[model samples]
Target: MSTRTYLPYIACAAALCVAQARADVKIGFSAPLSGPVAAVGQDQYDGFLLGLESVGGKLGGQVTTVLREDDQLKPELGNQITRKFIDRDKVDAMVGLGFSNVLMASLPRIAESGTVAIATNAGPSPLAGAGCLPNVFSTAWQNDGTAEAMGKYAQDTGFKRVYLMAPNYQAGKDYIAGFKRHYKGQVLDEVYTQVNQPDYAAEIAQLQAAGADAVFVFYPGGMGVNFVKQFSQAGLGKKLPLLSAFTVDGTTLPALRDAALGTISGAMWDVALTTPGNAEFVATFAKKFGRTPSHYAAVGYDAARLLDIAVRKVHGKTADKAAFAAAVKAAGTELKSVRGPFRFNTNNMPVQNYYAFQTVKDGEKFGVKLLGTPLSQHQDVYVAQCGAK
Candidate 1:
């Protein structure tokens, strides 16, 4: 046993360390890029890239490679993409796991592999509660948070009766539950429509017949456009107070235009936010992308900035999954988000401010104006079930 015999072993260990240090940060981004919600995915993707560009085209001083995929808002496609990112590409992190259904389908694989996933949009309640995974985080608010804000507003504003409507899905159900959690008023009807349903004439008729004081609906992307347009065309815009969450936003506002005017929606972020760094962000995004930045885009931008902090905290060593996850969690508090009062709850969902925004004419175009803050520093009701302390 010569002492010199250990030289090869030491050299081999050193080589391995150098190799790990030089490894690039690989992120896989999947979202519904080609379907009705394409704008939602596109805005998020663009914002993420903008964030990366702001950080000198790197995450934690490591060269980064992002593999983008289109899930087309389909759970099956999302599952396939998640598997490919995990089993084949071996990405260090995943972002934009698609809509709620798609995200739910991909969660098991993500948790099983212990891969870090930062969801820019989807925040299903199951993931926020007993199904909470340390590897997964949502930069976006919980699916219920904004709805809760609207519910609280409706309740506080003394609305006696309201009609509720949403797409039939996990998020839609959660949204309705969230609304009921705060609004103790008479719910005239709980209308659940097919996801991406084109026509809402029947629902509007039923709502009109119900004679509710106000109407609350949860529709995003193209659905929002169609719903608002129809609601306006039906002359309900002048007859009934239309309140919503995600039904009128930057992603849908272009098509919505004057049709969405006077619509009050609950949200966590918008161009109307005067939070520090938001003005520059909005300006930069609009200049770069040629449109107003949506809450989805804000979340995506925040995700990249959060990762920048986390990856740097770990000194470009994202290979240590535990360390990387911890860093990301810690980065939640360290980063100044474009969305105000943002931090990760124990369940890895956002504890942030939710506000009421009214769609209005900004000069000649439609944009949201901050009406008031309904829920401040709100954490989801399901966080207690996460058992994360």
Candidate 2:
């Protein structure tokens, strides 16, 4: 009969966060660059930059210049870089987050400083659940959301046994958890490797020895390129079907070319999304950068759009964190998502469709193509868990 008895601490935390984000906003863009993950970082940056260009470099009535940093994919380095940005750059807000580990290390500082974070990428599940913070509003879905889509695909397609792999980290765990939620089949093996380790010979050997009907992985950035190359090298590509979330993207797909053939992936958006906004974005990105976009670009674009909406809501008043968060949340609460319809749950993550795509060769180029049905269909279970009513 008691409220505490019926609900968990995470629900309480979500409410507390929603209450605190009501004040001025300057926005900062932090991501990984000058390292193995640099490709993803750069794409994210380009997308945010494009958004700023659309609005003429001004957010609301305030002039905004992005302060970009290289996290180098190291936790310590990420913390230090974030500190320097907050202390020296005089930024009032943050956006275009690239990876989970980097975001994890810097989240406390963001929460402590009460600086609104536009969470463009890397939605680790804790932030969507127990660790949800009001100052942080995500433009991307959590890692699990996409992984869950692939898992359902596996289930629907009659894959009875699946082998899984991921670089050991918060995002990796979230990725596996997402897949398992929809896949009730036998797990032949679960392999966790060093984050961004360039070689997969040993793991590939083991996966080949396991003889799984299918394989699901969550490597992103450089790790994805290396894994795909090594998976092909180990000859597992001939032996197993591969399903992935964040394993192959626009940043890594060029490098993955032939190696990633036949691989399946899930996400909220891809460069091939047919929406007018997405088509415009892809056309602009390809002309500007001479390449197609990955989900990172779409997220970056969304983050910028998300920020623009928040600024427009209050006109010239950005010092209100709660107002900013509300505006961002409302901005996401519609059907104009890059992939299609997108909504927001109480946890500040997206309630959107999960798209299934496959890596294939088309004429002289290689890229992922849309393939199957949506798994979640504009829904995230977290809102029910949050008990917003």
Candidate 3:
């Protein structure tokens, strides 16, 4: 028991404490990585990784460890995974809940744990309104916001009779409702299909028989791919103009390819957008992933950037709850967003432009071309309902 031996033991203990203090930041990412909507989830996850890579795998001078979990696009599964993230993984923050249903199911747990959860997509109405939680923020537009833009465009273009179609779910309902809000036109029919329904033959037949001047739909992920492909196969793509939101984007465009040609959709961002940040993001993302990044990817990248700015502002001391939350809120509009100027509303959902885009052939590949801005500097209606500052 010499003084030299005791001194070495104390030095070792001090080193271990310092190393633990500098531990890597842990972030939990839960999404449907293996399902019909897997493509969308993968795009978001890829974008998240690309953002981290751009910063050399560190945020705010601290290395980050992302714990990814697949919710399989199921609400219950999402809840389970979120609990694991909060209790077992001890994640400081979370990102990437792909669907509204999954997000709704997981939000309570995330809020209860007092962990900040940034939505890369899935801006459900409930969360944007009365159920708004200070801990929840969305880098993406509210579900209804994009659809509302499409609806306004259709109305302005004089589509007197429009047929509406969407999946039978929370987001689907929100899309249709938002569309109807601004469309001030005759509605020939409204159809809601099973979320995972592969065959749209019956729906297409109904659409044709409805005698509508145009059709507005909201189908995401694989459902969008299937619906567009079948609609084209039915020879309806040329006959009837298709208007949609979240139906044709980077995730479904590549798969739909020629079939998606001429389909018009509304989104927060597109590859055709011109900005230094956007150009760099698109070039780097394509070079890294060997494909065009989707709107989903763009939002996911923004979410990562938002987190990085917040972490830096707080000096990586996320343990101080009040300071961390304030930093995150302040960083909302500070980053060089690829979507151009971006800011969060009172609801913590983005208040940005929703552009009209058409799927077209860009040289040898199919891509989105910016048509016009349907909703410029738009704020979600639910923002007024949300009491959060």
The sequence of per-residue lDDT tens digits that candidate 1 reaches over residues 189-264 is 9999999999999988888899899999999999999999999999999889999988899899889888888999
Q: Which structure is stronger by lDDT: 1 or 3?
A: 1
Q: Give me the overall lDDT of model 1.
A: 0.88
Give the true-structure RMSD of model 3: 7.0
Off by over 4 Å in 1: 1-23
Candidate 2 local accuracy as lDDT?
Answer: 0.75
Error of 2 at 385 (Å): 4.9
Runs in model 2 lying further than 4 Å from the true structure: 1-25, 381-389
| Per-prediction tally of clashes | 0, 16, 0
Q: Tens-digit lDDT track for model 2 on 157-185?
A: 99999999998999899889888998999
- What TM-score does prediction 2 earn? 0.89
| Best-matching candidate per TM-score | 1
Clashing pairs in 3: none
* TM-score of decoy 3: 0.93
Q: Kindly report which residue stretches of model 3 are placed more than 4 angstroms away from their true locations once superposed.
A: 1-22
Across 174-279, the per-residue lDDT of candidate 3 in tens digits comes to 9999999889999988899998789999889989888999999999999999999999999998999999988899888878988888999999898999956899
TM-score of each: 0.93, 0.89, 0.93
